[model samples]
Target chain A: MAHLAMATGFLLILIGAWGALTNRNLLRMIVAFTIADTGVNLVIIAVGYMRGRTAPIIDGAVSAADAVTRIIDPVPQALVLTAIVIGVGVTALMLAYTYRLFEKKRSLDIRDYTDLKG
Target chain B: MIKRFIALALVVAVGSVFATLLFGYTPDADLNLTARYYAERTAADLGAANIVTAIVVTYRGLDTLGEVTVLFLSASIVGLVLAKGTHAPHRTPVPVGELLTTGTRFLVPLILLLGVYVFVNGHLTPGGGFQGGAIIASGILLLLLADPLKHFSHSLISAIESLAGIFYVMIGLAGLFLAGGFLDNRILPLGTLGNLASAGAIPLIYSLIGLKVGAEFASILAALSETEEL
Candidate 1:
């Protein structure tokens, strides 16, 4: 299950990279970048997965005494949570930048912004 | 054509790296040193039922603070860059449909409530500040969708954001003075392992984080939605 999820994540990353690299539209590139972000998060989460362990939360089901053996790695989960939030902020910033660029160039094409600006 | 080929080549190279890592990857049969320590010590040290929350809110709290700062900076830049473009549309927008309008009216408050619940229970549950904040912003998104021209009060949003941020830092400072170090959750008594009020300052800190993050995201959404449709 872990391998399957990790593979899927890697595929998404590749697809996102491909789309971002080839796409001329700024909006599409942003979308592609977000897809890549999601992929990265997925990979990290999958990496933290242990075969038969549950989540890092200690409830009646998993006692703190045995949590070390029964839980998946919590560090990656924490790291990914931060990454996901940062991803949202980044996507918003990208959208804002794209909106400003369109306002300036009156176009969304990458080639349109290629000319040097003062 | 050449650009596409080069892009594909670069992608393939990256893909090979991922593939190699995947193939070489061997899942650890046991928790590593860091994970082991967190598992063993989190409940006793911070009393957070959710070990991930313990790690995020206390063990490595400075990183979370920096993450919040980065988010705040991005939100501010988005608002600043899009400010001039947010004038009301010159034309009337179509009615957003009865179901959406009515549903939003009925659901927005509930959604906001759920967001509060998630963050308030951060120490004992799977959800936390970021998830809760995103949930709240999603409610705001629903509102915008229902009424395209609806304006959120920028001052109110910024006030909530600033107050949450200020109080968050203040709590951290209080921890510094009273507890072991900055952002220590132990400044408040660790009630119990699974109670709502168990994790000392974690619930409070997470609630502040939730409010701050929600306000920032709402501002970003509002700014994006208010832009004149060119």
Candidate 2:
């Protein structure tokens, strides 16, 4: 299951990167970046997954003393939580830039706004 | 055709590297030293049933603080970018159906309640502030869809955002003075491990985080919605 998730995440990243690189529309590229961010989150979460192990939550089912053996790593979960939020923030920032770009250029195509191109 | 071939080649190259990494990876049979320390000591130290909450709000609290700041910055930049211009394009008022409006009014409170529940139980459950905040923002999005022309009070949203952020910082500082370290969970008495009141300041911090995140996201959404096409 972990391997499958890892593979899926890698595939998503590849597809997203391709779309972002090749797509002409700024909004489409932003969408592609969001997809890539989701893929990165998935990859990070999957890296910590253990077979037949439960979550890191210490409850009745998983005792505190034996949690090291029973529970998956909590570090990755914590890191990924922050990563996901940060990803959303970045995507929003990029979208804001996109809005500004559109307002200035009056066009959504990236090729149309090459004022600084040498 | 050549572009498609090159793209496929690039995908294959990148995919192969990940595949190699995946093949080399092996799940640990036992937790690493740091994870083991957290797992064993979290309940005793913080009295939080969920170790992830302990780690997020206490152990790795600084990183979470930085993450929240990043979100706040992004939302502010978005608001700045979409600020009303000298020549604001007028929007046509579209009437929403009564059924949709009534349904949104009925559902918004329940969604908000669910978001509150999720964050409040951060120390005892899988969900936390980030998830709950997203849920609350989705509820706001629904409201926006139901009544497109209705204005959400920017002042109210900013007030909640800033207040939550200030309270979070104050709580962190209080922990620095009263507890083992910064953002320590021991500032408040830890009730029973599985109880709602348990985990000391975890619930409080999570609630503040939830409110701030929800407000930031809603502000971003409102800014985008207010943008007029040129």
User: DockQ of candidates 1 onward, in order?
Assistant: 0.90, 0.77
Clashes of each: 0, 0
The lowest-lDDT stretch of 10 consecutive residues in candidate 1 chain B is B83-92
Judge candidate 2 against the unseen true structure and give its global Cα lDDT, from 0 to 1: 0.89
- Writing each residue's lDDT as its tens digit, candidate 1 over B174-220 gives 99999999999899999989999898899999999999999999999
RMSD of each: 1.3, 1.7
Judging by DockQ against the true structure, name the best candidate: 1
Candidate 2 docking category? medium
Q: Residue by residue across A28-84, what tens digits does model 2's lDDT show?
A: 999998888888888888878888899999888998788888899899899889988
List the candidates' TM-scores in order: 0.98, 0.95
What does candidate 2's lDDT look like per residue over B52-141, in tens digits? 989999989988888999999999999998887432347776788889899998999999999999999999999899989999999999
> Which stretches of candidate 2 lie above 4 Å from their native place?
B1-7, B85-89
* Model 1 chain A weakest lDDT span, ten residues long: A109-118
What CAPRI grade goes to candidate 1?
high
